[model samples]
Target: MKIYPIETGNFKLDGGAMFGVVPKSIWQKTNPADANNLIEMSMRSLLIEDGNRLTLIDTGLGNKQSDKFFGYYHLFGDKTLDSSLAKLGFCKDDITDVFLTHLHFDHCGGSIEFNKDKTAYQPAFKNAKFWSNKEHWLWATEPNAREKASFLKENIIPIKESGQLEFINLSEDNYIKNSELNFDILCVDGHTEKQMIPHLNYKGKTLVFMADLLPTIGHIPLPYVMSYDTRPLLTLNEKQSFLNLAADKNYFLFLEHDAHNEICTVKHTEKGVRLDKTYTFNEIFN
Candidate 1:
């Protein structure tokens, strides 16, 4: 199996919100804010090529939103979903599966796009089966007041409307073994209900796609949970447990939102699991 790091685009988000309760004084050290107090963030996705299936995990914010809507996020960079796929000598239709960690705008917005005449919305990956868990699908579709803004209907409904949506019935085990994808889904909550983090076995290494569960190296410390999480205390417990397991088993964390650092490993330290090393995808695989 081969994995490709797909750079969809970059955008800005309020550093304070991203870092949650962590003081700006500390987070700014790693992610310095602009004059607007927004820090640049990457909407990074992953492409897995295994035998006949090509799976894409998360589709960064697409270009269908109005300028006014996008202005709020301050989108930047030339990299886009199509461009990234072109670089890998593939196209959207080639994707057999789109495994969404959650249905937040940044993660699933690119799942649908405007038609040529802008008359109606359609599935961006026409031939792909969009994979999301039943719990998260319902949570996003019937969003609560707290997360309504993040779950845009336009980005979501088209997949189901296109007859390409599929739900994974989560098993009792933490690790969901899927024969179709050849990966285990590490189910997580707190950020959102039933966020599925893919644990891929690649080249004798366990590569975990750390969705919002651990955004960046800055969040390695126990208290650095995000404010966006629905249950912060629950997130703390989940993070601690995952970090301990990661440290013990030496898993390579593939970050989805970290703009600068692509992959990192944590080591057991006196202060708890801390960043041990960072690497680009090429550094380790190439």
Candidate 2:
């Protein structure tokens, strides 16, 4: 199987919000903020080419939102989903499956797009089946007040409306071994309800899609949970367990939102798990 990193775009988010209660004095050292206190972030996605199935994990924020809507996030960058795919000699129609880690706009907004003449919303990946779990589907669709802003109807409803949405069967422990997508899925509830993290064994190494569970290298510490997380205490436990397992097994973490660092690995440090090293996608994947 061949995997490629898809750069959809870049945007800025409040560093305080990204790092939660972690003081700016600490997080700013790693994720330095701009004058506006916003930190630049990447809307990076992953594309896996296995046999005839080209599965894309997360689609990034699409360009359908209004300028006023996008101004809040301060979107920037020349790389787009189409351009990235084109560089790989592919296009939207080439994708067979779209595995969404969650329904947040930055992660799954590119799933749908405005149709021709902008009359209607439609699935962006015309030939691909959108993948999400039943639990998350409900959580996003019927979002709570805190997360309502992040789960936009324009970015979500179209997938189900298009009749191309599919749910992955999750086990009781929230672990799926050898899923139909050709990887293991670890579903955690801390970062939203049932956010699925994909674990892929590729090139003799285990590569995990960090998603929001570990947004950036700055978030390696167990206490550095995002404020957006509904259950911060649950996130603490989940990160503790996952980080320990990751350090022990030496997993290569594929970061989706880290604009500067593409992949990272953690090791057991005296201060608990810490960033061992960082790699650009090419440094290891190539």
Candidate 3:
């Protein structure tokens, strides 16, 4: 099995919001804020190639949003989906499955693109069967007042409209069965309902895709939950439980949004599960 780290580009997000309840003084140490209080973040995605499957997890923020809309995030970087795939000798059409951890604009926006005529949005990976949980699909489609802004209709709907949408397990035991991906779904509700985190067995190691649940290494502490999460308390419990299990089992956490660290290990420190070590994908995967 082979895994590729796709650089979908980088953008800025308010550091305070990204680390809910955590003071800027603390988070700024790791993610220094710019003059606008925004910190640079990577919309990093993963590509898995094994047997008959090539799955891409999480598309970065797409390019269809208007300049005015993008002005807020200050999107910058030359590494796009096309360019990144080219580096790997593949294209969007080569993807057979698109496993979305959630439907947030940063995670799923790149899944679809605007047509040249600007009349309609279309699936970015036409050949890929988009994977999302039924609960998350509904939560994103019918977004609540708190998270409606994060769930853009343009980034979504097109996959379903294109007749390529598929649901993962609802009971928590259902894992997507593909030759390339033999992983369990770590479904959590704190950050939107039923957000799917893929736990994979790769190269004799256990790796987990830490979506928004643990956006950065700084969020290893249990209380460092995101303000965007619907249920912060639930998130705390889930994070603690997961961290304990991860520390015990020695799982390499593959971060999705962290700008610097791609993977990390945690320890059961007195302060909580603190960052033990951090490394790039190749450092661990290779």
Listed in order, each prediction's TM-score against the native is 0.98, 0.99, 0.95
Worst 10 residues of 1 by lDDT: 173-182
Name the runs in model 2 displaced over 4 angstroms. none
Candidate 2 lDDT over residue span 1-286, tens digit each: 9999999999999999999989999999999999999999999999999999999999999999999989999988799999999999999999999999999999988999998999999999999999999999999999999999999999889899899999999999989999979899999999899999999998889999999999999999888999999999999999999999999999999999899999999999899999999998788877
lDDT of each: 0.91, 0.94, 0.87
lDDT of 1 at 50: 88
Q: Can you write out model 3's per-residue Cα lDDT over 1-286, one digit (the tens) per residue?
A: 8888899998998888889899999989988999989988888898989788999999889889999999999988788989999998999999999989999999999999987798998998888999887788999999999999999988888889999998875663533443234667777888888888888888899888899889998888888888889999999998988899999899999888888899999888887778999998889877
Better of 2 and 3 by lDDT: 2
List candidate 3 segments past 4 Å from native: 172-181
TM-score, cand. 3 vs. native: 0.95
Full ranking by TM-score: 2, 1, 3
RMSD of each: 1.0, 0.7, 1.8
In candidate 3, where is summed lDDT lowest over 10 consecutive residues?
Answer: 172-181
